[model samples]
Target: MEKLDHIDLAILKTLQENGRISNADLADRIGLSASSCSRRLDILEKSGVISGYHARVSHKALDYKMIVIVHISLSGQFAKTLAEFEAAVKRVPNVLVCYLMSGEYDYILRIACKDLEDYERIHRDWLSALPHVVKINSSFALREIIDRPNLAASLGS
Candidate 1:
């Protein structure tokens, strides 16, 4: 990867705050010409520094009122076993995120559901049926303190 200079960092920081900002607006904010800003943005996208733009939706609006954090232990740590488990888990609808961990648990999952009854159904039908899953521990989140989609500090904002 190429080293990002001050201007590149500025562009990234600005985009992180508003992904949908127009090229003219962004250029004005960054003190660059519209064409220059557009060229820089193209380079950023081509280099994979700017991955994608997406809307941040409210889970509650979608009727997902409960957030469940699940810790899972697999029967084995072999690559085949882990790959099978990951592939299977991806097919589970309520699973929002899954991470392969380095601690006691092999994987950790963040799930969204309507309520306890909905979670119960997912736990019984989907989670328990995942391949090679030996243990599952779940905890409900009371409230979300913070969720940052951008890396402001890392970008030197």
Candidate 2:
């Protein structure tokens, strides 16, 4: 991948603020011609620096009121066991994020549900179906203290 410079950073920042912004407006904001700005953005996209654009949706507005953070420990650490666990987790629609981490737990997953009863159903059916899972610890988030969608782009320089 190509190294990004100040101009690239500016383009990234502008895009993050308004992904739907027209190329003409973006060029004006970045002090470049429309064609040059378009070319730079295309290069960024082709190089994998710009993955894709998305609209940030409000979870609360969508009636998703609960967030569950689950720390999971697998019984075995083989390749097959890991793959099976990941594949099962990927099939669950409510699971928002999953991370493999260094701790007592092998995997941590973020799950969304309507309430405690909804979570109980998910735990009984989905979480329990994964392979080699021995322990599952859960914590409920009372509130989102800080959340930002354009985190990576904001860090660019």
Name the candidate that leads on TM-score: 1
Residue-level lDDT of model 2, residues 58-112, one tens digit each, is 7778788999999999988898999989888899898989998887899999988
All candidates' lDDT scores?
Answer: 0.92, 0.89
Model 2 residue pairs with clashes: none
lDDT string for model 1 (42-125, tens) is 999999988888888899999999999999999999999999999999999999899999989999999999999999999999
RMSD list, candidates in order: 1.4, 1.5
Clashes of each: 0, 0
Candidate 1 TM-score versus the reference: 0.93
lDDT of 1 at 37: 94
